[model samples]
Target: MGIDPTNPTGIKAFVFDVFGTVVDWRSGVAREAQPFLNRHAPDLDVSEFVDAWRREYSPAMEEVRSGRRPYVRLDVLHRENLVKVLAHFGIAGACEPEIDELNLAWHRLDPWPDAVDALHRLKRRFIIAPLSNGNIRLMVDIAKRGGLPWDAVLGAEVVRAYKPSPRVYSETAEILAIAPRELCLVAAHNNDLAAARRVGLSTAFVRRPTEHGPHQTSDLKADEAWDFVVDDLHELATQLGCAR
Candidate 1:
């Protein structure tokens, strides 16, 4: 039902989800909290706080994505949730600057083991960019921090809509100067892939079972039949006939 990149098919571009697809935001954010917690709340068990902090991701995104709340960057959403989560844990002693630095942890997420090399291979073969719910600035910051080789960055800010919205996918294609069918949406989230399929964009699923850590309960594997289901981004490059 979708174009296959390795078949010498019509797809010429790949749009990726940045958060979990390319970078391990959960673990990365949690790791980034380690030093600060070690210095401040040495015995506070920041691991639980990290997990609890991530629990708010969906609900926060839904507010902006569903139109119940106005467009807000994920950074702001993370911070908004961070405040509540910190209070919920009764973790105190953080000042404005400290909170600001913690808020930026999302921008410095480490890419998966094979993500960089694979992205380079994919970039060599096609127009590769991020099409995510993250704002352009945040995406750019992450790319720079992670050294991601993206030809361009596309985000919900560009379309004023989020994933699962046809307009977002369509707009990404338009911005890349490619047709919907010529673009493939690569993500770790099934909902994201499903949205691309509905909008006429090919889909590739890169499994990220550990994205939510030990408590991850969903998205352990591809749910819907996707055009491709690679174990990691590097495998995706190889499957697409990319050399090395």
Candidate 2:
């Protein structure tokens, strides 16, 4: 059955997929990496480096999702991946502190221009939080830096599993004390929404066409007929009857 955006009566909460949906992770990571790269591997393309780092994200989490490794926070995985990415680029000799600071780029990501205001508008009518792969601290820092008004922070650390895992979606609803059907997952990625829908949550797709960069080709349009599909958070807010 399809959801009616204008009258989503039972949805008490709106949980977001943060990285590319709410925050521009690719550009933000490249921006934060610029100074460090200039000092280290000046010749390395910042965009390429950021993409390489992002490519490591899912595989690292799969280790935990598959239960091959115990759950460790995203920060730890990012740092470990950072070391490898640095090595891959032949940019050796980065100190521990340097790598640690650079890994924090995830925390400093910028929101889409429509995000903060749309979230605030949505917040007035429903519970709003992140259902991201990022750990608590990472989510908190991103929210703080970007002025996102979340009622609570939630994700991998809280659930002990990364996204696309049924537990991540079902457990989040459990934590929020709402039925899975009463919670909605808003994301730019169809796979994330598909997982949420599989677990009985409503799903919304917000387009971030340039999330991966100008030449990006994937996830430009909704692959499935999600509960709601909008060009940006602002449109979602409007469709959901949020005040200006």
What's the TM-score of every candidate structure? 0.92, 0.96
**Which lDDT values do the candidates have, in the order given?**
0.85, 0.93
Which TM-score value belongs to model 2? 0.96
Candidate 1 segments exceeding 4 Å error: 1-7
Candidate 1: C-alpha RMSD to true structure equals 2.6
How many backbone clashes does every candidate have? 0, 0
Worst 10 residues of 2 by lDDT: 1-10
Model 1 lDDT, residue 91, Cα: 70
The alpha-carbon deviation from the true structure for residue 206 of candidate 1, after best TM-score superposition, in angstroms, is 1.0
Candidate 1 per-residue lDDT over residues 103-151, each given as its tens digit = 8888888888898888899888799999988888889988888889999
TM-score of model number 1: 0.92
Cα displacement (angstroms), candidate 1, residue 218, comes to 1.4
